[model samples]
Target: MSNISVSENEASSSEPENKNSPAVIEESPELQRASSSTVPPDVPSDEPPDAPDGGWPAWSQVVSAHIANMISWGYGTGFSVFQLYYKQTMNLPAVQVSWIGSVQIFLCFLVGVASGRLSDGGHSRQLYATGAIICIFGMFMTSLTNTYWQILLAQGFCQGIGAGLVFMPASASVAVYFKKNRSFAIAASGCGSSSGAILYPAIVQFLMPSVGFPWAVRICGFISIALAIVGFCLLKPRELHRVPAPYLDLKAFKSLPYSLFTAGSFLVYFSLFTILIYINSFAREILGLGDVKSVEFVLVTNAIAIVARPIFGFLADKFLGPVETFGLNCIALGVMAFGWIGVHERIAMYVYSAFVGFVNGGAQGLFTSAISSFVPDVRKMGTWIGMTLGLCGFATLAGPPTMGAIVDANGGKYLWAQVWAGSTIIIGGTMVLISSRLVLRDSAKPSAI
Candidate 1:
C-alpha cells in the first residue's frame, strides 16, 4: 500500500508540470508565435553584401588590374615606333599604316563588349588566362611578319582581341571590392598605362638598333609573359553566375545622366587618342628632332601622367567628385589640344607635352571612375562598363584615322584637325557638366555617386 501511494504521487506531480509547460507551447498561439521565426515581407534575403573595401583581398585585385592595364595600354604606346618603322621600310602610305593602329584599338574595345558580359557570368579567370596567351602569341607572331596583311592579322586581330578580353574583366574584378575609394582604386590601376607607356617606348628606342626590330618585339613578348603569369595568380572573382540580363541594357539609355555621360565618354576618346598617335610624329617631322630625341619626348609625356593620374583620382574621391573632376579634365584637354597649335620650338614643345600628358593622363584615369558616379548596382558594373567602352570603340576607330586624313588633306598642317578636336572635346565637357548637375540634384544617394 505504501509503494503504490508513492508511485501514484510521483506520477501526479510530473503530469501537472508537463501539462502546464508543454501545453503552453503546443496549445497557446501566443507562445507558439513567439518561438517561430517570422521574416518581414519587405526585407530581401538574397541581396548582395557590402564590399570589404580595404583588405588584402581587395587590394590584391587592384594589383591584378594594374597588370592588366599594363598589358592593354603598353602595346598601344609602342605603336608610334612601329608606325615610323613600317612607313619607312614598307613604302606604305601614312593613312594606310594608321589603319593598323585603328583596327587594333577598335578590336580591343569591340572584344571587350562580349568579354565584359562573360565576366558578369563569372568567367574572369578563363578570359584573363586565354587573353594573356593569345596576346603573347600575337606579339611573337608579329615579330615574324614581313607584310602588312600578316602584321594586321597577328597584331591587330589577335592582340587587340586579347587586350579587349583581359583589361575589362580585371577592371570589373576591382570594381566589386570597393565602394568608398572606388574612384581612387580604378584610377590607381590606370597607373599601369603609364608604366607600360614608359617601358615600351624606352625598350624600342634603346634596343631596336642593337637587337633589330624582330628581337626588340620578342623582348616585349617575354616581359608580357611574366606579367600575365602574375596577373592570373592574383585575380579572384567574388561574384558568380548572375541571372542574365538583356545583351544591351537599352533601359540604361533612358536616364538623362547616363545618356549624357555616354556621349561625353565617346567624344573624349575621339579627341584623346589624337595626341598619343601624332605627338611623336609632330616632334620628329615639324620640330626636326632625331629618332632617339623624339622618342624621348614620348617618354616624357607618358612619365609625367603617372603622377598626375593618381592625384586626379584622389581629388575626385576626396574633394571635387568624379563627374565634376572629369568635366574639368575634358575642358583642360580641349585647351591642351588647342595649345598644341602654338608649340613650334623644341623646348616649348617639350614643356607642352608634359602639361598635355598630365591633363590627358588624368582624363584616362578618370574614365571608369566617372562612370561609377551613376552606376548604383555593383553587380551590373561589367555590363555597363563594357557597353560604354565598346561604343567608345567606334570613336577610337574613327578618331586617329580621321584626324590623320584631315592632316593629310590639309597639306600636312595640323591646324584644322586641332580645331576639330578642341571644339568636340569642349562640347563633350559641357554635356558632362550638365549631366553632373542633374545627378547631384536628383540622385537618391547623391554623395555615393
Candidate 2:
C-alpha cells in the first residue's frame, strides 16, 4: 500500500536475476528439514505469527488482491464467451475458435515466469500496472478484431499475457503477508477466479444480447481498468529484503519426487479449463438442456468450488502436511470424477457439477500448499511459484483443445472427452500418492518448529 516507485535501475542494479547466483529461499529449521532433507513431514506444534495490528488494512490487502485477481479471471473467462459470440455472429469454425482460447491460456502462464521474477525483485507494482495496461489493451483490441488470428493475438495472446502478469504477483503478495492462514488466503484468491467464471459468462450472455458484441467487450475492458487501479494501489512485498529473481531451476529436476509432483500438477491443471469452458455446451448439446440451464449449471459448479477451496485449505493447514493433503484431495478428485459417468437428467447434472466442483476446487487448495512445502525457501517463492505454475500452464494450454479435439473425434460428443479428462485426473492422483511418499521419506527432520 506504500506509494513506492521502483526504478528499473534500482531493480536491475540490486541483484543479477539468475537462479544459480546463491541460496535465497530461507526457511525455519523445521522447514529446512521438512523440505530440504530428511525431516518429519508433520504440521509444526507452535502457533503462527501474530496478526498485524491494523486489522482493516490487512483485510483490505486481501480484499483488493482478490478483486484484482478475480478481474483477471473475468478477463480470461469473458474472452471465452467472446469467442463464442464471434463463432455465432461471425461464423467462425469451432477449431479456429478453439485457438483463441488456447493461445490465451498458454500466454497467461508462459508470461508468468517473467512476471514472477519481477515481483521477486521488488518491482511488483510497476510490473502489475504494466500487466493491467496490457489487459485493457487486449480487451480494446478484441472490440476491433474480425478475423480469427486477430482475436487470437489480441484477446487470446495479449489478454492472456496481461492477465497472467496480474495473477502471479497479486496471489504471491497475499502469500507474503499471511503465513499461518496462507491456505485460506490462497483459497480466497482462488475464489476470485471462480467468481470470474460465474459472473463473466453471465455478463457476456446478458450484454451481448442488449449492447451487441463490440460494446459488450468494451464494458469488459473498462472493468479490467478499474480492477487494475485497485490492485496497483494495494500490492506490496511483505518484507524489504532484496532477493534474486529465480530463473527456472534445473536442479529441481534432480529431485525425482519434485519432478513427479510437477508432472501430476500438469495433468490435473490441463483437464481443468477444458472441462470448465466446454461443460455448458456439453450440457446443452449432449444432454438436451436449455441454454439458461446450461449456464446455471456452470455457475453452480463454480459457486460450490468457492466454499470448497477455503474449507479444504483450512483442513490442510490443521491436519496434514501440504504434500499429503494434496495427495488426499487428488484421490477424492479422482473418485468424484466417476460422478460424471451418467449425467443425463437436470437433477443428475446439478449433482455431478456440485461434486466435481468441490473435489476439483479442494484439489487446488492442496496443490498450492504442496508446491510451497516442496520448495520451502520463502525468499525464492516467487520463482518457484512461477516455475510450478508455468508447468501447470503448459497443461492448461493443451487441456481445452485436446478435449475439443476429442469431442470432434467423437463426432461432437463429450462422452469420450469426459472419459479422457477423468482418466487424466485419476492418473494425477496416482502420481500424487507416489510423489508425496517419496518427498516425506527423503526430507530431513529438523529440530526447531
Q: Which candidate is the best by lDDT?
A: 1
lDDT by residue (tens digit), candidate 2, 215-234: 87788778767777887787
Candidate 2: 10-residue stretch with minimal lDDT? 36-45
Candidate 2 runs further than 4 Å off: 1-58, 77-80, 90-93, 444-449
CA-only RMSD, every prediction: 14.8, 8.9
Q: For candidate 1, report its TM-score.
A: 0.87
Residue by residue across 1-449, what tens digits does model 1's lDDT show? 00001143443333211222431111223112211111111112232446766898888999998898888776875577777778768987666777777777887888888888888888999999988898899989989999999998988788888889888889988777775576778888888877888887678778999999889889989999999999999999885448776546776677677788889878988877777878887788788888888887778888888888889888776667777788889889998999989999899988998998898778888788777555545566777778888898888889888888888898878899899898888888888777776653342221110
Residue 432: error of model 1 in Å? 1.7
Question: 292, model 1: CA deviation in Å?
Answer: 0.8
Cα deviation of 162, candidate 1, in Å: 0.4
Candidate 2: what lDDT? 0.67
